[model samples]
Target chain A: MKPIIKIQNLSKRYRLGGNGGARYATLRESLSGMMRAPLAILGRKGRASRPELWALKDINLEIMPGEVIGIIGSNGAGKSTLLKVISRVTEPTEGRVELYGRIGSLLEVGTGFHPELTGRENVYLNGAILGMKKEEIERKFNDIVRFAEVERFLDTPIKRYSSGMYVRLAFAVAAHLEPDVLLVDEVLSVGDMAFQKKCLQKISQMRSHSNAILIVSHNMIAVRAICEKVILLSQGQLAAAGRADEIVPLYEKLMLENVKTETVADEREEGMGIIRVKSVRLVNRAGTEARAFDTGESMKVVVEYEARQRAVSVVAYAAIRRPDGFICMGTSTRLEGVVLPPLEGPGVVELEISELLVIPGYYIMDVTFYDENFEFRTYFLGRKQISFQINSSLPSLDDKYGVFYQKHKWNIDDVNVNSPAHR
Target chain B: MGLTSNENVSALEPAVTKQTATITEASPIRHTSYQVPDNPLVVIAPTKSWVALNLGDLLTYRELLYFLIWRDVKVRYKQTALGAAWAIIQPLFTMLIFTLFFGRLAGISSEGIPYPIFAYAGLLPWTFFSNAISNGSSSLIGDSRLITKVYFPRMVIPIAAVGAGLVDFVIAFIILVGLMAYYGIGLSLNILMLPVLVLLLTLLATGVAMWMSALNLKYRDVRYALPFLIQLWMFASPIIYPASLVPERWKWALALNPLTGIIEGFRASLLGYRNFDWKTLTISAVITLIILIYSAYTFRRMEKGFADIV
Candidate 1:
């Protein structure tokens, strides 16, 4: 089968600096620039050789029909640029994209929605902008309104609606668009949880209709859930493409490594001259550094610090956080009433747990150091300082769902069928 | 030392984990090949030619153009106390001012027709032309969000702005009819040429608008310069005065301004005040066509840069 979308040697270059870098330039500035560099102006080039940034470089990809591909990347990784290029929102500096069948792009929800217009009017207007025919919009009008759940406010201008309502209406109009090839860019992270679920369901439904959907999103959970395949991009280049489960973990590990190196460099450069944190590590029972631990395994968090001068009554804190940024556990020496020795050149603080009860998933550890009065006179004021993973080896423990793994047993005492208190 | 005391740690754990699974369970991959109908395939690449007016795309996106025009017309009068009445009020009050200043005070000739109705007829087309150009000049900037987010024939935006002005033109045309009736002016065979004149006026406005709107996306100087340009252009046209008022040598120059013939054509057609000046009308048609073709090419050349700069 022919691919729904095929891109060849795609590249987009943006010139940096000078008036060219600005969105628009005034006539006076342009005139002066031309006068200052007549030869360059005649040549239709910048006065100096302008630096260029390639938003996308030499990208070749083919997406088959009925495939849902997730694009994952850090910020500035050409994800949105790729979508824009594919949708023809912006022309590429080089190369070409061939697309089969009708294409619809939802780079942003409510691309042409007017606040002054009523919700119903905006639906028609936005639908038209998304390439839906007038008859198409009219046919799906009720479905769009019902999905938005703004039936009562259909006649009211969207400016009067709450922000949630506005997003819902916008997304609803976008969701109703039926195209053989659909390109979406982070529009799923809109509205409340239930509405987001509805949108995900809508997207999965689109996938089942034999449409090719390309989604650029930072939400790992959403990408993992709906996409069978994932593409990882880094620095405007295709880094990897594989199955969703495999590529997502690889992307996460790359992100964690990047964070670790950046934080270590930051610590050396900005060490406040009072107390500096040298390293933070997670160790298992084998007395070796580890990033993965099974449920109920022994784990220790060790923090090493260097003090410039004698300081008395220092306090230390450690907190474990889930990938979703929820802090599972937080503890401090001050809260526990522990006193520390003074005049430390170098010292180590360890938090040991006999049983690491965290459920199987990725987690982050944050450490803080301060004076006994809670004044942060120490270095390393950062979040997500270290990240680790958890896995469950026990089948019984894997079935239960929660943040922490708890050991419990169930006892079944059979009540005799023939002797229910002689009832 | 171990810091695992229960008093020291804050466990903000919820008692119940409802586990409302939002992620759909991954089904086995099905290699279902979609049988795409013979829909038109689109190939996107960097423009190779200097001029690429994909006018067919305008036809394909005609519904979008209509919706955009509807949106403009719908939103223009919103929140105004007078609502659509402002459409009639703008040209009506402008005609009053022009009558007071250019007609009575300046003693400008109206070629034998009554000054009020004469000026009203000229103002009708002139108002639509100027508003279309002014609105079209900034239409792309105003829809910058749409430009950057969606793909359509970029020309549709300026065309829609020009199209939306027809609503006001039609509304103001009614007042022209009322003025003509009050002045005892009756329709003539020349009146049949009104649609042709209106078409020329629309073509001229759309051409200039497409050029200015595309330029405005890059320089923004068009925005600051447009209103002033419109005022000068109104004077250049035969709106408040007759084309014959100009010296003979300058009359040719006046004819060079396309509005000269189009405005005069409107008056001659509606009021039957004078024989149709076929030479000036022909000049107007040719110039309108030239501007339309030239501006379409320029707009096409600049189209690719719109989403990036906008």
Candidate 2:
């Protein structure tokens, strides 16, 4: 099948300084500029000497029907710029994009919603702004209201609604857009957990219609859940593009590398040369250092530190965080009521887990050493210093829905079963 | 399974190999037998020259235009104590002030008609024109959120603002009708020219509004300069005075102001004071068309930069 969307040699350039970079030029400056160089004003060539930054450069890709692609990048990586170019909200500076059928872009929810208008009115208004015909909105009006779950207050002005209801109504209208190609930018990060889940379900349902969907988001879990293909962008260039499982991990590593450089500056200023963490290692049950582990396997974290002074009443803290900034597990010596001996020289601290239940993905460990009372001063602080991966050999354990996998047993009518009979 | 092998190969080589492998793998599945649908193909590229005014898109998005106009009319009177009454009150109170200052006190000639009715007739269209342009000039900046988030004909926003002014014009027309009855001035055959004159006024207002709105997006000086420009414009037109007051030597120049013909045409047709000045009306119509076409082109030229600058 032919690709639904094709982008060829696309690039976008933005000027850096002077009046050229200003969002809007004042008439005074423009008049003076014209006076200074009358010929330049006519030719519009005065800005050629200014420094320029390319938001996107030579990005070439094709998207087929029935495909959901994820665009993952750090901030200012030109993810949103590419979406804007495709949506035609802004003209490209070079190259072009060819699109088949109708296109809908949700760069933001509630694009044209008014505060004084009621929910019903805003639905029609916002739908029109999103390029939906009036008949189309009328046809799906009930489903939109049902999905939003705001039937009781449909007549009330949306300004009177709670923030959660407003977001649901806004996202509801956006979700009902039936275009051949859809561009979404971090719109899933709205509303409560249940509403977010409902939105994800609605988006996943769009795939069955064979529509091409492009999602640019910072939420790794959502991208991993719904996107079949993923592309990584760095500094306005395509870095990698492949299956979601492979590219998402590579994107996370790139993110970690960026974080490592930024934290290196902070470490030098705060280390104070008193004591610091020299190394952190993750080991398996066999006592060999390893970076990968299976679900329900025993794991150990060893922290080796050097102390320049005799430090007493020191508390050790460690936290395991997912790539999306969710803390999966946290532990501390103070919370466990363990006391450590005074350290005047290099020593090692070990944290052992009998069984690690985290779901299969990448994880980061943060270790810190605080003085007594867990305040005042820190001997060592390592943020995102040690990274590891958890794998699941069992196909049944390959779910990405939750943070941890709980151990459980199943029985039917008091009879033990290896798996559920329903399966 | 394909990803696993590709990963192993990438691990041995460099990162560039992974990109090529993914592209090559995805490119081989093209099906030549697949039939492409008849959907419209849109090309987005950098605009280099003058873009054609794709008025067909205006026809396609007519419903959005209606909704935008409806929203403006609905939200304009919200939270106000007087509601839609403010529409009639604006022109009514302006007429009263002019009657006091320019008619009763200054004894300005109203072409042998009652000063109040003649001034009210001119104020009806004048108020609409001023309101439309002042509001329309700021419409694009006011709807900046929509401009950046979606792709629609940018012309709809200013047109909607101008369209919403008609509702107020109709409401104020009722007062003119009541005043015409009190003066015992019956409708004449020339009344047929009323619709034509109003269309000319609308076209002229829409043109100026579109031009100013597009300029306002780039310079922002239009916003501050607009109200002052309107104030001076009212004095230049024949709103408070009759066109006959201008000496005959400068009557041709006075007709150059597009509102001069419309306002004079409104008073002459509605009051049966004189025959329609076809010469002035013809000039007004021609100038209105010129401004409309010129402004439409200027609007299209500036539209490509709105989403970026706004």
Docking tier of model 1: it is: acceptable
User: Residue-wise lDDT of candidate 1 within A1-423, one digit each (tens)?
Assistant: 667788899999876646555757787877887686867777867644767789899999988776789999888999999999888888999998988867888899878889899999999999999999999999989878887889999999987776678888888888778788888999887654577887886776555443688999988888988887899998899999988989987887776566556533232223345766678888998999988888778889888878777766667777777543356787878778877777468888889977777777667777766555323223233222577777776455432466676654444586433311112
lDDT per residue as tens, model 1, B1-310: 1111111211321111111122233444434435655543888889987666778999999999999999999999999999999889989999999999989999998887788888998889998999999999999999999999999989999999999999999998889889877888888999899999999999999999999999899898888899999999998988988989899988889999999999999989999978899999999999999999999999998898888877
B1-310 per-residue lDDT for model 2 (tens digits): 1133234434654433433424325443422222446553898889878789888988888999999999999999999999999999999999999999999999999999999998999999999999999999999999999888788899999999999999999999999999999989999988998998999999999999999999999898998999999999999999999999999999988898989999999998899879988898889889899999999999998998888888
Q: TM-score per candidate, in order?
A: 0.77, 0.77
* Ten-residue region with minimum lDDT total, candidate 1 chain B: B12-21
Off by over 4 Å in 2: A17-22, A39-45, A264-423, B1-35, B38-40
User: What lDDT, from 0 to 1, does candidate 2 have?
Assistant: 0.82
- What C-alpha lDDT, on a 0 to 100 scale, does residue A43 get in candidate 2? 76
DockQ (CA atoms), all models: 0.29, 0.27
Candidate that would win on TM-score: 1
